[model samples]
Target: MLPSCFRNICKNSVLPKKTFGGAFSKNNFATEATFETKPYRLHKLDTSPSTTVTINREDAIKFYTQMNTIRRIETAAGNLYKDKIIRGFCHLYSGQEAVAVGIKAALRPHDGVITAYRAHGWSYIMGVSPLGVLAELCGRQKGCAKGKGGSMHMYSDNFYGGNGIVGAQVPLGVGIALAARYKGTDGVCVALYGDGAANQGQVFEVYNMAKLWNLPCIFVCENNGYGMGTSSERAAASTNYYSRGDYIPGIWVDGMDVLAVRECFRFSVDYAGSGKGPLVIEAATYRYSGHSMSDPGTSYRTRDEIQEVRQTRDPITSFKEKIISANLVTADEIKKIDGEIRSQVDEATKQAKIDAEIGLDELPADVYSQSLEPKIRNVDPFKPLVHKRLGAAVNI
Candidate 1:
């Protein structure tokens, strides 16, 4: 049997192969398709971001392809962790693909993005390749961070990367936004924290500061119901994380829906860039895995509950259905795309396993741009470690 952490997750998530027979070939795509989203619940505002989103065939293909790929990558990560290939603190973002993908869809390339430890999807969307991410997890030389930063610490351009500390990334995200604001650029920073971190004192403090300074930061609380071992109801005084901003405007979004997530981000970018200060967005999403790789995820929540979410609210499954029904692409095309992604993930996993680990001699590499001291002394002072600058600062 597979590890319980990966229970109910379909690695391929393949849409059943069917012969199109050229029935719907004529209308392979419409110029654009309009879909209504789940209504947004607004705080401190009268109007909401439009519930209607317009997506073209290209948009549909992009979202489905990216979302499915994220799901497959996470599933592969879970399997590697089970096989003990990827070790330590692996958080699978199997069900939260829509949130990151949707946000990216609505964001500018230069816009900053920072999130919690469950950030493989964010890293991929932020331009880290599947191979780079998997290699990083496997601690191989080809990793995005060159094998130094593991599951939680990969960084990319305009991406602050995932912070291991619960709420530490919030302030960093604000600073990224602050820098953009300082530079007078139109980019915004998206700082995402989990519901578990929602009650952090620093979150509220930064909210006040962000509002006071009117920084172009979009603070997001990814309320995935259960934080680590506890449910939101047990951990939080009020799960109304969006409304907790008080002074800052907040929007409650259905994170399971990619289009809805996109609209919320689009709304947030506009509002924040318009000198309206920061906005709080609560993405009501769910994670299939436990908080990290260690937990079974079944102890806090029932197997039945997890199964139900996979069947009903799964971001990838639902979006796949939506696009297929809308005729953006045929089911056969989807199955083929799924096959391609699976091959890519499998190949990446194989390469990651074969890639060499950084040697002990290079232990002190990539620590600093320039060091005053020639050697970093170890517990055994005689074997002083020499810091080697192998490559440029940015790995990905």
Candidate 2:
């Protein structure tokens, strides 16, 4: 039995009476209710000036939980893809959780976010449900994109698509920023692209336009060391992606560190919002998975190298250690959070598997504006094409 004083304290406490999987109930502890403000020193990968990074205990736990959730969800996605549940090209954002989570942490709900094909984590962080992401992967009707978008095209409010075309989202992101500026809103658009996309001709074109208009946009290059199966060193003459935007000031950040990413993102967002024009941020991150599910991920990089990164520089593990060392939360609390996330992912996967598959009729829908009718080709070459009338209701 608990001590009388502790029991009374629990009953009288004004904070939210939530328990951590019943583990803290007996101890009269509330892990989520506790928070401690601490100064977080910034570590810039480039010569950019330093800034302070502050994280309270509550925020730390939240970040840890979010990162863990992304990791588990990606793991579940890999399993689903391997089992043939998810079709088409599926890219798992396993090792790069911190970048998405950290960037989202620094943005407002109305701020825009656009990224490349590896965007399940970004979708989730930008307010899309995990079940929606999983369903979209499985081509189910209840997906965020209604199963039409599939793995490379999930969209949400203020969160643009997982564009299949490399670097295509960069121009779209710039358009969003221009729209925001034209409307005189204090919103900034974060345009995220892979190292490979950074080399695209259109990206530089958009960069020139963005700087010319002084659009409140951030060009974030996720330099995961590899572009597809090729390393960045082999792909580009210079790997200094941050400085790629000649006139635009840039910052290089240690993307493996959540705090650093979050702090740097906050700074960039503020800088852009101040009408300083577009800024570039090159995040030195990594992806443990292959370019896609098909690649073995070991043909170019050795297994030892992958294992070393997982062992030493893993974002989730390192953040957990930081929290524990700071005495913010007990190891048991972190374990409980991990267990909860695993269960959540398991349930989401089960639901995604059983969800109804999208109907073929949806192919013609959403093809054009509601005011314009569009004709779709028939599967049979000899058959007449079907014309979908405008304003016609689609059966969900």
Best by TM-score: 1
Query: Per-residue lDDT tens digits of candidate 1, residues 1-396?
Result: 322212212331223222222333355554456677766778998779987787777888899999999998999899999999998889999888999999999898778999989989999989999999999999998999888889999988888887899999999899999999999888899999998899899999999899999999999998788778887877877777899989998988888889889988888898887788899998888888888888999887789878877887788888888777777777998999999999999999999989999866566566764567776554233454444575433221
- Model 1 TM-score is 0.87
Give lDDT per model, in order. 0.83, 0.79
Off by over 4 Å in 2: 1-51, 368-396
lDDT of 2 by residue, 284-332 (tens): 7788999999987888888887787788678899888766755557899
| Model 2: lDDT to the true structure | 0.79
Poorest lDDT segment (10 consecutive residues) of candidate 2: 34-43
Worst 10 residues of 1 by lDDT: 3-12
Per-model TM-score versus the true fold:
0.87, 0.83
